[model samples]
Target: MSEVNAEIARFDLLVDAAWPAPGRAEDGGWVYRHAGGVTKRANSVLPLGERADLPEAVDRAERFYAGIGQPCVFSVGMGASPGLDDELGRRGYRLVDPTLVMTSPISGDEAAVGAAVEDRPSERWLRTWWSVDGGRHRDTGEGPARTWGERILGGVPAGYVLLEEGAVGRGVPQGRWLGIYCMAVEPHARRRGLGAAVLRTLLAWGWQCGADSAYLVVTEANGGARALYEREGFAVAGRYHYRVRS
Candidate 1:
């Protein structure tokens, strides 16, 4: 594979290291992941190879997520088979969450705000994360959401970063790369450079941890986020879209 193709192929492994999946299975060349059905990404299928057995793999993935009471989702990336995405579309799977995976070299820059990095998320950090991403109240029972934020995130060697009056982020440094996840800044905190500060803080942390590069995923339509990351020297490394059964 070419260099770009190799990165696309290895993308899922990198993400799995960052956002852990507590419940996982493999069929044919597909990786089926579920974290108590909390998030769609965790419960999605990653087709790593193009093979004659792909149909069987799809069947197994569908059944696996169905057993857990979640819709079957497939994350289609650049290196996937040429017709695989079209096949899913023909199968009544609507496209959702077109996302871009962006990457950049670690920079030695100062953060606008002091970011508190922790091995475990404090109650405040968790609350902040859920507030922006979760529609329900933070006090909602420790169901799949908690399992995802606490168990899955805690499973890896992670840095949960909370910025004062600004932003929240997570970083997982493994090997030569650091994966940034769950970055959010409050609406009122926008345009004050808090987002860039949160990102720079993570990159600084990654550099301190001996990471040479950093990567993050963002929704394709999030223009503000894309622009912010671009200003921080990140470029689109690859793209993926989810296919959910209709």
Candidate 2:
């Protein structure tokens, strides 16, 4: 595979490892993921390569997700089947949440006093992660937030760094590389260098864990996050998007 394809494949692995799905299988050049009734990333089809029976594949995807009470969704990346996005578009699937995957060299920094990095997420880290990501809704409603939280935050065998009064992030290692995820700062904590601090801590941890390169994914519309990653030497290595039939 080319560099972009390799990076994107690695990113997809990281996503699967980090988010996790209780029910996962493969068919027709696609990876089907289902996690009860939680987030799209954990319950979507990943079209990785070309296949002869894409229509049957789409039907299978629809049935699989519908069996689990979820609308069908597909993750299309740079390495996905050519024209898959257009095919989905023609099938009434609308595009959503375009994301950029970025990579950079790992450079250690001084660890902050309040920063806590661990192989598993702490209670505070879990709460902070969901609060900033999309966990707050379950606070009042009868949503499956806890289940989603458990799968999203508890499945990774990687570093979970939480900075009290600062920020929170995750770093999952795959071979000599680490992929960072869930890096978030509270609204009150913005513009205080805490975001950079969270990244610095993850880099230090990745380096200590023998990682040479580190990567992270951010939505294409998140300019502040893009700027921050760029300042840390990260560049856009690949991109992906979700197409859903709701």
Candidate 3:
């Protein structure tokens, strides 16, 4: 692999460790993950390395998710096996959530502002996050999905940040890399700089924890968030999307 591809693979590994699923299986180089269908990141397959029998591996992944009563989804990133995405597309899997992985260096100059970082997510923090992001799926209601989401959050050690003004975010520092997740601002709190404050607080916390760089994933459809991350000096480091069979 080239240097760029190797870097993408490193990020992929960091992302997997940062956001873990309770139910996990391995098929060849593909990881079959399921966490009550709460989030695509937790439910989808991460196809890394190579598979000698690609078709059989794909069929097994489909059956694995079918057994769990969820759609078979594959996360296609730069590090995915060659031609796996096209094969899934030919198998009638539609694409979704073309997401950009943005990254920036933590300069240790970010101010914490009004946000507070906690060792674990509080009820208010989870409430704010679910309120903003829970409607992504028809079955992702706050009650049961919240239980599953909490499990995923606790799977790894990380810092959870909540802004007093109704914004929330999470940061997972691995070595010198910080993976940011669960950034959200309440509808009533838009345009008040709370989201940026929460992001800055997380960056500050990550830097204090010895992380020199930070990364986060955002869908291409979210223009407001893309703008915020760009202003924070995060550039597109890689791209990934999910192919889901309905």
Regions of model 2 farther than 4 Å from truth? 1-7, 108-114, 135-143
lDDT of 3 at 200: 93
Candidate number with greatest TM-score: 3
TM-scores, one per candidate = 0.90, 0.89, 0.96
- Cα lDDT tens digits, model 2, 1-246, are 687577577677677776777668888668898765566777788778777777777888888877767678998877677777778899999999999989898765535445668888878887777778775233313247666557656676888888888579888877778878888998888999888888888888788888888888889999999999998789998888899884
List the lowest-lDDT window of 10 residues for candidate 2.
Answer: 134-143
Indicate the residue-level lDDT of 12 in model 2: 75
After TM-score superposition, what is the CA distance of residue 66 in candidate 3 from its true location, in Å?
1.1
Count: clashes, candidate 1: 0
Across 1-246, the per-residue lDDT of candidate 3 in tens digits comes to: 799878976777788899998889988788998888888898899999877788888999989888878889999988898879889989999999999999999999998884568999999999999999887645443247778888999999999998867899999989999999999999999999888888999999999999999999999999999999999999999999999885
Residue 222 lDDT in candidate 1:
91
Q: State the C-alpha lDDT per candidate.
A: 0.79, 0.78, 0.89
lDDT order, best first, reads 3, 1, 2
